[model samples]
Target: MWTVAGEIMGLWSRDIPEPNEVTFTTMIGALAQTDQFKEALELFRLMLRKRVPVDSVSLSSILGVCAKGERDIGLCHGLSCNAQGKQIHTMSIKLGFDRDLHLSNSLLDMYAKIGDMDSAEMVFVNLNQHSNVSWNIMIAGYGNRCNSEKAAEYLHRMQCDGYEPDDVTYINMLTACVKSGDVRIGRLIFDCMPSPNLASWNAILSVYNQIADHREAIELFRKMQFQCQHPDRTTLAIILSSCAELRLLEVGKEVHAAAQKFGFYDDVYVASSLINMYSKCGKMELCEHVFSKLPELDIVCWNSMLTGFSINALEQDALSLFKQMRSLGFFPSEFSFATIVSSCAKISSLFQGQLFHAQIIKDGFLDDIFVGSSLIEMYCKCGHVHGARCFFDLMPGKNTVTWNEMIHGYAQNGDGRSALCLYSDMISYGEKPDDITFVAVLTACSHSSLVDEGLEIFNAMLPKFGVVPKLDHYTSIIDCLSRAGRFHEVEVFLDTMPCKDDAVVWEVVLSSCRIHANVTLAKRAAEELYRLDPQNSASYVLLANTYSSLGRWDDARVVRDMMSDKKVLKYPGYSRSVCKNDTQMILENKQ
Candidate 1:
């Protein structure tokens, strides 16, 4: 037959003179099979030129072309294939294949591949009859949009329509459940699989892994081992991730040995995970050993190294690694830029932040919300309120996080009025306030002695926004009242607060008592603080300070001697000053 012969001739090219429709269609299908999609599209074009009759088979082949084209064509190019696809659609209508179920399914898949769910859904609704493939494609479209409810509805409708769910159906269904965090449903599906493959097992474990059920996932891994199934890179990655979180050093070593035995250690993802595991375990030497033994470093490995340094408080090392990454011709991603900016923020290095900000603007990453948030926080940390506000205004997309950062920036700068104004503006802009928003505004009120405003916001929390006040909210209210010397009000408020075990609230009250020289209230607060956090040196230090403030030298000496006996240490605070001669001095003496 010409069909079987065309399959063989697919290996080589020859011009066939006066080929029939079957020969042309067979050749085109073979071209697509060999991944010569461009050639396939070209052949389709030639068929159109010769006015060859089109049918469901050729229409499906070209429709497959559109889907593959969207993927293979990067973001900037690939319009020509789409243009060709539009012409194909017109041809299909003329050829009476538009109503063909298989052809329509191909059209649906093509539209979904390119993120046009509207068009995909349109085709689905217009179908005269539904196949398992149709149901699966519809579910996949909703799953891609994270519409788990709609996906679930379709699964029910598919069963009602007497179409048995297949492997692809369950896989897409599980993906939807995973996105929705319906672990219960995920388990049910996994249990129903007649013969679950490795991918199925991995997907199930991934569900447990994402929700941070470390013990459950580890137990599942052990079960997999008992079944004598080999652990792939994903399995090892998941297990090592749990090992890092739980700090199971010995277990990590065993997993590392397993990875080595399976020869999966050389894979970049596994290696990056290994680096993260070792880094988080505080095994810097082991981490470096792993890095050094790597065949070569990739971008992910470099970012992991930088993240390791940043998390371990080695800001300088993180910055150094970032520079090295760039010098090695690795362009920084959003995560990389945010991490580096955080290092600058941690060190309060305005100069370095400005340097990176310049690069961000030049590279057009200034519009990146993550990087912009980091920049705003960094400017606030470095005492550049104007810079923080400028970035806040320039950010085109201002979410609740951006608003929170800007409000907190004002609060930290001691501009309570501006902070309140921002909060009002946030309300006007319809950005809902979260817990952090309340914390920032209340902190602003506390520092500025806006007791009335603080109390009003505190009262409005539950009624207006349905946000119940937490320990921070209560603590802020206490600070606000105590700072204004409303000692009686502080007592009533503390007694009425819903949360009683708040050591932080007591600590704030103790500090305020020290400021007002209220030895009685200070003693009560210190007692509660010591009871809550026995080892907190702040309680002892403030208690001793309270005694000294009352001119009770003997009592102060007694407190100091008690601290010495208990081995409590003071956490010193620092201040930096520049003298008249422009010489800088840093002091770390007392609070």
Candidate 2:
């Protein structure tokens, strides 16, 4: 009642007069109710500064806010919520609520949300009372911290203490499995559950989705139907995400039909997932149709629709929507700007990219690290590699992707020296190079013919940074040796690769053979490439071009006829000024 009266009084009261203990707590409640969590916290601090008596009621509401804001809270925005949680704990003790179990539980939860399992355990230890909720919080805390082993340890302890596992307990344990990406352990826990509920199944399915085990996610959804557990909106969302990523259009359409039948399409999250799925599958028409059907749209929905257009190479459509989005009185999110900037990069539109760059600055998202990275990429894609480097240097921070983009830009612009130097600096600055970084630097080495440096970097990747080379690495080295006309080195390197039949590397070798007019090697590479990736037109074109260079018209005609038989349309030609890396492959035999 006091809290209620304080809320009404607060709206009308001028000068915001200070209140007694009851009214101070009331004002805290009123602030919290209005979602003015920061203000509520400020009032709590004022209560302490003015020496007002504090109690559990005010502590409970404020603690809940701090707990939920753990990820979101930052020192720059205010006192770190985690730091504030500790401060509030000190206040709780001063006010004689230290022994209050309910307040202590809230404290334990706050620590857990911050992934401070040790502090949570300390609270759990000193508490004179324990409940299943307390145990569950601890287990869930470890899971949130990705310390699945510790979560399992607590599960064993909880069961030994005669607190038999309930549905919630099992859910937390499975959540640990999900965090660890251990399908086996999650399956074991699910099988032992006395009765698994919908959330429990969703949790496991979500794990599969997170790990990109899309096939398992699809199978599990089918099993859910067989077991007669009605899949809810969340279930549909997760399954649709899997379908979108895997490009399983048929499965996604079936789920879409089911969503309409069950009315889950009414849910914004479900509808958004469907929009994303359709765009990923290259069905922009469906993406637009589903988006237009929404009763209302939020910023997230707008971002999704714009992202769909950008990723599908519909830059013009994305720009149209961007104009429409702002006209609807919705501001673009940082992600929205980043996605549109990426679209500009894709289409290599320098003038348009500059426009978005100005807009990002006007919108005050220039400081967003992702938007900054996109600006670098946009400049690089527009053929201004030096400008890209300038943006990269100006940014306050650089993630691996940003570093890779700069390195790639230098390599593409034929500035191998700068690319290599930037890579060295990336290590000096302690930003770990990932597989993409290796690909970029290796390509840099190939472009500059820095063979020894490239080899050393490639060899050091696994030992120094624990990055394993994928097929792209193999193809890059082949490109390096092939361009340098080192046929012997190429053959030796090919022998060292795990598989000689790697279609991409063979294609690279074939391309090199075509450039060097090494008919014998070209024939060998073409035969192997055709055996491995027969549908690829580049391999046949390379072989036919090599034949034509040697004045073997019949052989060249046979290859062209083969393409015609396979119904493979030959690509149009490129100007000789194109980048040397991909230019050879996309060339035509214009005899």
Candidate 3:
């Protein structure tokens, strides 16, 4: 079709001495329809250069092309397209076509698609007439920008103006909810639909997935099927993602079969999703099979397989695949670099991590937050806190994760003062700390025996930072007090915890009791741990050791007898090391 259009365009240009308004408008619309946007723009310019009379139809067609072309080229080039659109708008006003309904609507759509909502609103408000297209464009534009409030306001205004909400309006509203993560509002919008279509189902399912409510997404998908709505490629892909998050391999397989049945198995996105689902389920063999069977591979497919290898502890395999990808001239995305860097961190391959860091810098991904965060983690895990700090300081932007990594890195390296100072700086910089930030700071206090400081931070968590203390925060505080031989404070804290029965808290107490030879507290902690984790030998061993250290041989014997009666044997400790070749070796303590 494009070839025929091109041939006809060539003939028209050569054979016609001077093309009139109708001929120019027809050719411009045809070129735009075929996605020949540059040619269409050129023809419009040629018409202007020749001083051909521009009609409302021709101007509208050119505006439509500008809107679509702006979207395709992205914001940088969209600015140029937007300027050209404004120039055309000026021409329309000069020619007395600005009041033309079709041309005014075209102006509204052009401004909206170019992300000039201010101009779009101006065009919309000044128009003497409104159409469904005008309202839908405004709603979709605001929705795309994640301004759900504005989109909802537009919806209300649209109805008040005597225009009934249609399927497209509801879908746009649902999309706004999806972007804003307003799950309840999304559900309300979806439920308000008189009869939702496949696109609507997919949009609502995405809402659930976006919030990590994978179980709800799966249930909604089941309901969708019950309503006799056949799954499309988008549906299968969203459900498969939900399945991956929940590690529901069986459900994922069902979605995979559905994709095949619907003849969407070959679609690049669906195939990539299958690989991701299998990879996340720890089914690397299946992931490999699906990847190998793909007739053609896009960048997404390659990245999925690389992530699968990294997650499955196949760091060497991931590195090999990454090398192969680069060899094949497949440009690595930020995700690809981040994944490989993470694999390097897991295996403690500092040399390989440094190589990848250089590659990331060379590829100009050094500024990407994800890649920068990964580099920080890799350096920290490789026992290079200085290197991590260098990257952290050089980062032009830092999110909560980036700060958390650097603080945790310092905490792990026993630089508690530095970690706490960084946390203070984070606060002063106006970066809102999350739960993970508290955990990192608390852990720093624990390692440095700053029990008072740790407790103060924990107390201020909800009030100052609006961060609710989770189990890890509690664990860190407990560890901090216990390490300082403050058993009374530990007891008081444990009693105040909502999850007092949690075995991890008792384990921390018991370990500290063993260290300080507090036989009574050791007994209490051991009993709780025994009840919570039966057949585990750690609690029994710790209690017996504490008793024996205080010369209570009889009590120690009794505890050993209890362990023997329960038939619980202590497992040997092990240490892991990574070789230069990226192979992991586990050394077990025979003692």
Candidate 4:
């Protein structure tokens, strides 16, 4: 097809009769559709060279190709200027073609698409009569680039002047609302819809979904259906997202069935969402079935399947699928690498994690914050805390999550001093710590027995930074005091806990009491622990040990007898067998 188009050009220049504007317009349209925009531009240049009079018909055709913004609009603008610069307004000087509205609209659209609003306004203001098509393009230009305030102003003014908005204008406004997160303003626009079409319904639905109001999203879908407006691909996609968030497997299944009902299962977008929904809800078998039915795959489809496998803890499968993507000639995107790095974290295989890390560097995505964060987490979880630190330092930019990862990595590796040092550095550099940062910092203080430091940091959190303490912060404080053997202090603090005691909090106090051999406090902590974790045998066993260590033999025997009656078997202890130089096998008692 390309060769024939090339041959047509060869004949046109040699001996063919002068081609009319329609011929040039038709050929350019075909070339643009075939993605040969450069060749089409060359043909337009040839016409200009031969002194063939160019009309708005030919000008608009070339402008249409620029509308995609794939071509250099600057060069297009230059050509438009050369053809009609200051001397001839092609839209006004049309001779053979009856005032070409389509071409004139395309010219206005090209200027807007390139963000050359000065030229666009010039064209717009010069229009002999305005049409909804041209007006819609200008409104969309503002919205497409996230100029919401300007879009709203222009849209409102356009409406006040008696120009009724079409479906395109409403979609633009709805998109603006979704991004701006003005749900109230979005609702106002929704009510103002003269006649809401399927696209408008889907737009409103997307706004609700983005803000995470799943119930509202679904309710809108139900309303749309009850109004007899059939759901399209976009509607099904939105419904699938709502189902994923709610984890309502039944609703997800219903949506999948609806997709098949409307032959939308073949849509790569909707099908991908279905796979994601099933996988997120923990139905791997159903996810696999949906994934296998997809006829073709884009990056989105591949990412969905890869993420599904990752979420299901199928590490080997996820890696294999990623390799398959490359072997099938699909370029792995940043999301693909991030997903594989996460899988490596779960499997705790440093070799695989490094392999993916090297691939990320090769792809130039190693600097991407998402990929960098994943690499740091993978290295930390795999016992390569130093390697994780190295990557964190090498990252070009760091978000709050990146800083939190480093802090948590230090705490998990028992480098409490280093964690505290990093926290100080983070503050010195003016990076405000979030709640997760406080958790890591407090944990570090707890591990290092720095009670005074922990208290200082905790107190400063609410007053100095306005970050109120969460359950994690409270737990960290309790754990720090207990690890320091301040059992009485822990008990006093527990009495003042604003939130009810959870298993972890009670476990903290109980563990400290057992360490200090405080019989009365141990008994109380045990009761609280048992209330939180009813089936916990360790709580009962620890309480009995507390009694035995205190020389209360009768009370200890009674606790043991109760355990026997309840079939709460105590864990047996065994010593390890080791060779002189190398390791040896030993059969330890099974708890």
Question: Which candidate ranks first by TM-score, i.e. highest?
Answer: 2
Supply every candidate's count of residue pairs whose N, Cα or C atoms clash at under 3 angstroms.
Answer: 0, 0, 0, 0
lDDT value, residue 90 of candidate 1: 76
Question: Candidates' TM-scores?
Answer: 0.76, 0.81, 0.79, 0.69
Q: Sorted by TM-score, highest first, which candidate order results? A: 2, 3, 1, 4
RMSD versus native structure for model 4: 7.1
Local accuracy by lDDT, each model: 0.82, 0.84, 0.88, 0.79
Task: Report the C-alpha lDDT of model 2 over 1-591, residue by residue, as the tens digit.
Answer: 344334544663665665667877777777666666666676677677777666797787678878865565455145788888998889888888988988998999999998777789888999988778888999899988877888889898898888888888889989988888777888888888866799998998998898899999999999888888888999999999999989999999999998988887667788899989999999989988888888888888888899999888677789889989989899999999999888878767777788899999898998788898888888987788878877778887778988888999888878888999999999999999999999999999999998878888888988999998788887887798898888888888777877686887888898888888888788888889778877888889889998898899999999899888988766786454322122122222353
Question: Candidate 1 lDDT, tens digit per residue, 167-267?
Answer: 88888888877888888887888788786667777877888889998888888778777877788998899888988888878888888898999897677
- TM-score for candidate 4, please give it: 0.69
User: After superposition, which runs of candidate 1 have C-alpha atoms over 4 Å from their true positions?
Assistant: 1-51, 61-169, 461-468, 487-498, 518-524, 551-591
Model 2 stretches with alpha carbons more than 4 Å out: 1-107, 114-116, 119-129, 226-228, 517-520, 535-537, 544-591
Between candidates 1 and 3, the TM-score winner = 3
- Superposing every Cα of model 2 onto the true structure, what RMSD results? 5.8
User: Cα miss at 239, model 3 (Å)?
Assistant: 0.9
